[model samples]
Target: MQLFSTHKLRNIQAQEQAIKKHAILVVDDEVANRKVITSILQYEFIVLEASNGVEAIELVQKHPNPESISMVISDQRMPHMSGVELLSQLAKIIPKSVRIIVSGYTDVESFIGSINKANIYKFIIKPFERADFLWTIERALENFELQQKHDTHLLSLEYIVAERTKELADKNIELEQAYKKLEDISLTDPLTQLKNRRYLDKHIDAKVGLSLKAFQNWQKDTTNPLPHNEQLTFFMLDLDNFKSVNDTYGHEYGDEVLKSIKPLLETLFRSSDIFIRLGGEEFLIVVRDINQTDAQILAERLRKTIKQYVFVVNSYTNFSITCSIGYVQYPYITEQPNALSWQQVVKLTDKALYLAKNNGRDAWVGLSHLNNNINENEITKLLDPDEILTQNNTINLVSNITLTIK
Candidate 1:
């Protein structure tokens, strides 16, 4: 253990000796003062002497590297540009250089002022004790080395932190792209790339909740005049005899037919309109702030457009499809407060869709006629499969009929 301890102590001493070889700059106009300070520091540090402040500044500027000249000790009252003036200039040029001022009793006040301006680290009085002066130099060099090490450590830490932050930012961007891909997969219809029923349900639920809240708030404020026009129309739609096309031509052709129809539907509706493929040949449309007449005209136009639209599978094979539409206008449902729920509005539109299908394969039916039946509780109940539109429309069945309502 003693032998190992001796080896470790020798290694430490060598490392310290290498560090002490780093130089110190001593500036004093008095030759004797410079000699005394140099002799005291030379045993532990490499000492450089300057006869005046100008020479001190020149030596310090020449030694650009901080490790070369660790500290500067100068007399406050020098021939030209005092120690404080040289130090103040040095402070701006090399902020890390530690500065100490040596002064006599007469120059104390001036030294104090210099201390504040140049931020001199320490001061020593003239006629100083040899031990005190030596100790002060040692302490100043020690602090200078410590500060250098601290600055180096901080720079290393900043570099590591900057690298880590960049890595994290890259990871966040990758995650966002992954999330976007997932969202596209979730909401898109694989065949047509249009929004699917699941997306429609989530979006409509939020919109309906907002609309209901707004309506309720407006009702509470009876003193304010009502808006001239306020109504929401739900249009339900279905492709006319879509299964027949699937049966006559293959399912591949049926898929082609659905794909062909999507662009037309998208063109017919405004961007603000919500359109969705509810599955198979069924679709739903939600149009905001439209009157019953406009809603009916819109539904009729869609039905006519689909009927005229031809689906061509091949150069020789051409087929045509029609649509059945049903719509219900809200605020027409009931005059009673909280009279109509969003589900009931949908149910009434579904009922209208049923009537359209019942009347004929390709036609539009309006549910303004059924407005009397809508009450808050019943409208809420319409969301329940059992209480809403008949199972014939609610149940998903592979059949020959096409129906749609918005």
Candidate 2:
């Protein structure tokens, strides 16, 4: 009971009109009967005549289009082939065409049982009324058009379903790709192609959480405690007079200098080491199993490389840049009375970096450790990466051993 839109209705009507344009083929062996049937139908339709079933089939083959010869009317009991036989052939050739049989007998036995076999639309007596004959022809054509419309409607529905399904699939792919891009942007610094501060915050929190859980376990049992042989080194780096570079050469050139250092830093460190940019010319390196001496050696090499390498801003403009670095090596040990968090160590590292900046612009400084008051609650709050990254400046520090990057 579905209704088609106005536009779709117009399309169906147009197709039906093309289908109805074909001539009606009237078959009869008798010359007078053939002329009589043709004459009657000629007023409303283009009528074609065939002497027998074979001739009728030949004419149908010539006009093989579904639109051609929409209906067939024939006299039964012909010389060679009967009306029923001709209609049977037409059924195979043009299945949609309406078939009708005519005869002189009042009680037609051949048609009586052959209606289903020949697929007859209607049958008329030989001495038939002109009104009844015309009415039968009109109804048969209407039946043919209705069948065409129904088939066309089914095909249209299938096409619409296919198109909509494809559209939904395309939208799903787009959504998935967009989600992946957002995930990448969250962890990456867009300018330097290095890990962002957010990634550092998340990573630091995860490490601290495990450490705090161990600290709590140690509190419960004074005998069993977490092992602290693993040491992590932090190289907090600041580009010397970076604001002056941007002011002199423009922000584009400043961005070029930042991007250019990534390969230099990557070559100096292992894959396990994490390189980070904390917005605007400040960078950090976190390496595992490293001491102040080894960390300062790496920082010195990086400073020398940057100072010597000509940063290519453009074909016409090239410049040299330098970075000052300070490192803090923090060690975690089992059963240590007052354990400092890595977050606290990061804060202390920042202070030592400022000392290097104050002494000389391009030198490096290293501190052995910042012995911290172990508060087990420190790890629980480490879940918020933003807070850990933006640590407050008011933390108290008890400092140990020291070194520098040339």
Candidate 3:
């Protein structure tokens, strides 16, 4: 009989080795109960013994990771702490581990609380059936393995999502940089390095908002008498006879002349001023917080500087250039309302530019003189074709004069 029992035990041990060892921690103050439980599970599982809650807590802390501890089995009655208490502490350290309680006392309330709070997986009576105990432990180990697999899958998904998010963010930043580079190329004038007309149209609304805010602030200060000179000015300057330069000296020389004039204009004005190239031979200047006189002075100074600086195209060729300037100040005719619209101011300045071209082509003109002439009939007549120019001159008489001079 001894020889037969030894052979059976050896076969069981060989089968246990073929399967992976599941670790189990048993907590009990009674040495006999702990020995019995260990003996029952030792054949299939690697059993660890803990005499009380303190020892169980230390064991759980020592092997906190789920792969290290498969399950925990504790007795309800102990010296320092109860089974429920030990399970609750273990739940904090290793929440995924399976927990079971073996109790002789039939206190239903505390047992229910333990199930609710500590998430106990199973409960066994003091006198447990051998087959039932073995089946319960096998079931607990299976559940534990399933939970570990689920947790691993969740971790892998989180990692993949994090990596994908970072890649998208980097691509977004690259796209924004590419867009900004294209915008810079579009808004720049290649010859003069100044802002082109497209930039002006895109930002005009923001400029209008700023002007409105300034007008509102000026209106609010009623006690302080505002000066007549505190108003926005718009200056329109055009190069005189620019087409002649391109026709006489080449387009390249004309481009050089335009490039040279930009710096002189920028140096004569304040940094708060905005200067823009509104196409060939035309420029617009927006000077804020300046009165009509200061704007006119600035324009005249720019004109004089250009006239004095004789531009040399190359080693042997040189020429002189001139400019025509027209300006208009806001609040042209102040009414009882004490406010003027920006559109009206721009119209006045445009009219002033037309007058400056008609006056002599190389002087400055202010819109104050044309304020009264901005009536409905005059505006209608100005738009009429018959009032613009006539082309019925005698060419035969001019040819005769030219022949006599020759």
lDDT of 1 by residue, 309-376 (tens): 87877899897888888777655433442566566677777766766776666877765533333444
Please write out the lDDT profile of model 3 over residues 1-406, one tens digit for every residue.
4446888898987887656478889999999999999989988888889999998888777765644777899998899798988998889887777999998977788778878877999878779888889999998888888888888989988988988898988899999998998897798788897778787677655655565655556667846555444466777788889999999999998999889867887788876666788889888777767665566677678768877889987798788988777677655442211334555566656555555566566766665422322445643443353443111221111110111110
- Which residue pairs clash in candidate 2? 228-332, 228-333, 364-405
The runs of at least 3 residues in candidate 1 whose Cα sits more than 4 Å from the true structure, single-residue gaps closed, are 1-23, 31-69, 103-118, 124-139, 213-229, 332-334, 369-406
Consecutive 10-residue window with the lowest summed lDDT within model 1: 391-400
Candidate 2: stretches off by over 4 Å: 1-22, 64-66, 75-89, 103-119, 123-127, 146-238, 244-256, 259-277, 283-305, 312-319, 324-406
Residue pair clashes in candidate 3:
none
Local accuracy of candidate 2 as per-residue lDDT tens digits, 69-123: 7788888888778888888888988888888888875665665766877988887
User: How many Å off is the CA of 60 in candidate 1?
Assistant: 5.5
Global lDDT of model 1: 0.74
The lDDT of each candidate is 0.74, 0.73, 0.72
- Model 2, residue 194: what's the lDDT? 95
Q: Give the TM-score of candidate 2.
A: 0.52
